[model samples]
Target: MFCNKMLELQRVYRQASLLALITIYYNLLEGAVSVWFGAGDETISLFGFGIDSFVEVISGVGIWHMVRRLGRGETADRDPFERQALRITGGAFYLLTAGLIATASASLFQGHQPQTTRWGIVISLISIVSMQALIHFKTKVGTALNSPAILADAACTRTCLRLSVVLLAASLGFQLTGIGSLDAVGSLIIAVLSFWEGREAFEKARGLGCGCSCGCTTSTKSDH
Candidate 1:
């Protein structure tokens, strides 16, 4: 019986580590595109897009830490450290979200509309779509594997996908209306959504000690 548990623990740790590596790699690519096109177009949405990718880097690190602490043998018996990391990431997400919204809103208020770049548009479109597919995959894999890290990774991906709607809207709005302010408004909306989702994750992580992803197998005090 103990052997089986240890084997499952090993599998979960490996999967979480894989997830972390993938996310970080994608984030780096995202950051590069955002920087290359953002300044040229002077678009807040595009620039903030980069920041959003970088933000996920922190979340990925948290998951990595969780995987490491939950590693082999004796350490496996210790409580999952990922929950505390999730709480911290959740709070940071909210704070960063507020900043994203404020900056976008302020830009809109100031009537700062930016020109769009073709590369930026293409990347954003591809990113949003690709992430949607990944989100679906994560959902399935996490459910099947029943790993908190997998679940948390999916949740983060979903959050980004949701925010992409606002981003796309702002991008198109600016393109059509010749007003950059729409971009800012879009950013503000993203911030609100981020805060709401982040807080939800925070509460779930704290109270349940789970990533709020489906199919959790962890035991609680009441369960014992």
Candidate 2:
């Protein structure tokens, strides 16, 4: 029975690692396209959103590394490595928040109106669908694996979904109403949320004495 359980865990960890890699690839493509169009069209919101995608790619990599350790039969609560990974993910989120804020503020100050680009709208719609599906699968796998890092990774994807909605709204609004400031405003909102998420991750890391992702203080807690 013990051997069966270990095999099951190994299988799930492999799946989680594959999902993380897929996320990295998707975000890389998405970020490249977004940055290209965003820069060409001078859309601050779109550019900031692209930058966020790249940051998410880093977070995915961190999670993938941690899960791979588990796949190698390493203990999940290994303090040195797990804590380092958590801190890396947390710091990346904070950096993303700062970048978004700075970009949005500069755009607002300059009164730079984002030119309507149909590509922004299309990309955001695709992101919404893709992120939602990822959220579902990540949630399932994270729960089965009982991994806090993986679950936190899923939460990040949820934030990406929200950002996509904001991007779509800003893009469509600019296209229809010709309002330039709305794009900056959307980016500002995303910045605030990113900061909040970063803070939450940091707090979780600090509270994790056992280095498990879920923050259970005792062995009685489910490590599933």
Candidate 3:
């Protein structure tokens, strides 16, 4: 009976590891596509969203590492590598935020308009569906394993979902009204959220416990 339980635990851990890997790879693809299309279409919101995905890749790598350690029956405490990843992720997010804010401000000031927001609409729709599915599966696995780290990662994905929604709204609004400022406004919102995520990453790295907007504090407490 005990051996059966152990095998089950291993299987669940493997599933968690697989999910983390999927998140990392998916973000890479999404980021690349978003950046390419965003640049082609001159959509600041989509471009900023793509950069955000790249930052998420860094965070996803840390989650993958944590899963590996936990699979080995190690403690959930943030290790040196995870801490470093968090710091890097935080810095990247901050940089992205600043860039987006600056670019968005300039675009607004110049009354710059995107060539097209159709791609933004398409990308955001896909992201919404993908993030929702990931959240569902991650939450299921986290719950089954009673793993706070996994749950926290799942919570983090919600921020991605929110970004998608913002992108979609801005894209759709611009498409309907032929208003260019909508895109810049969306980029500004993304910058605000990215700034918040950066702060959360730094806090996590410092072992301050989760005060993330994603409501992960309840689950993350177990990690501390």
Candidate 4:
């Protein structure tokens, strides 16, 4: 029975590592493309979305390291690193929220109209489909593995899905209506959501329960 448990855990770790690597590569590509097109078109929402992707890369790499540590049987050394990652994730979100607010405000007030980019639509569509797939698989794996960190990471991925929706709506709205301010409005929404997520992540890291309905981070055991 002990041997069987060890094997099961090893399998979970392997799966986690694979998922983390996929996330890293996907985010890097998505971030690069979004940033490129967002800058070219001066769309605050796409630019912010691109920044979020890069932040997710950091998160994915952190998860990869945690999984590797688990594989190496170094469970005792994981808590501090997990805490730090949570803190960093929270901090990044706060910064992103602030930037989005400033940029969105400027766009709104300065009559900064954005041109429609074919790439924004393409990126948002790809992200929506891809992130949804990832959330499904990652949530399944995390539940099966009984890992809080993996579950938290899955939750984070869900937020990405929401962001993709906002991006798509903003991009499509602008493309269809020619209302350039729609992009800025969408960016403000993203900022509000990001701020909420950041506060939750930061609270969970401090052992203050994330307030998620799932109670995923109610305990001080671990977080992502």
Model number with the top lDDT = 3
True-vs-predicted CA distance for residue 99, candidate 4, Å: 1.2
Estimate the lDDT of model 2. 0.74
lDDT of 4 at 170: 91
Tens-digit lDDT string for candidate 4 (1-224): 99898898788778878987998999999999899899998888898889888877766676678667756666513466666776787789889999999999999999898877456788999999999888888778777776665776677788788889999999899898899899999899988887877787677556575322112453323322
Residue 41 CA displacement from its true place in model 3, Å:
0.4
- The stretch of ten residues in a row with the least summed lDDT in candidate 4 is 211-220
Rate residue 3 of model 2 by lDDT.
95
Q: Can you give the lDDT of residue 191 in candidate 2?
A: 79
- Model 1 misplacement above 4 A: 1-16, 67-84, 117-120, 204-224
**For every model shown, what is its TM-score relative to the native structure?**
0.73, 0.81, 0.96, 0.86
Identify the candidate with maximal TM-score: 3
Per-residue alpha-carbon lDDT of candidate 1 for residues 91-136, written as tens digits (9 for 90 to 100): 7767768778777767867777677744446766888887887777
Top-down TM-score ranking: 3, 4, 2, 1
RMSD of each: 4.7, 3.8, 1.9, 3.3
What lDDT does the true structure give each of the candidates?
Answer: 0.64, 0.74, 0.89, 0.77
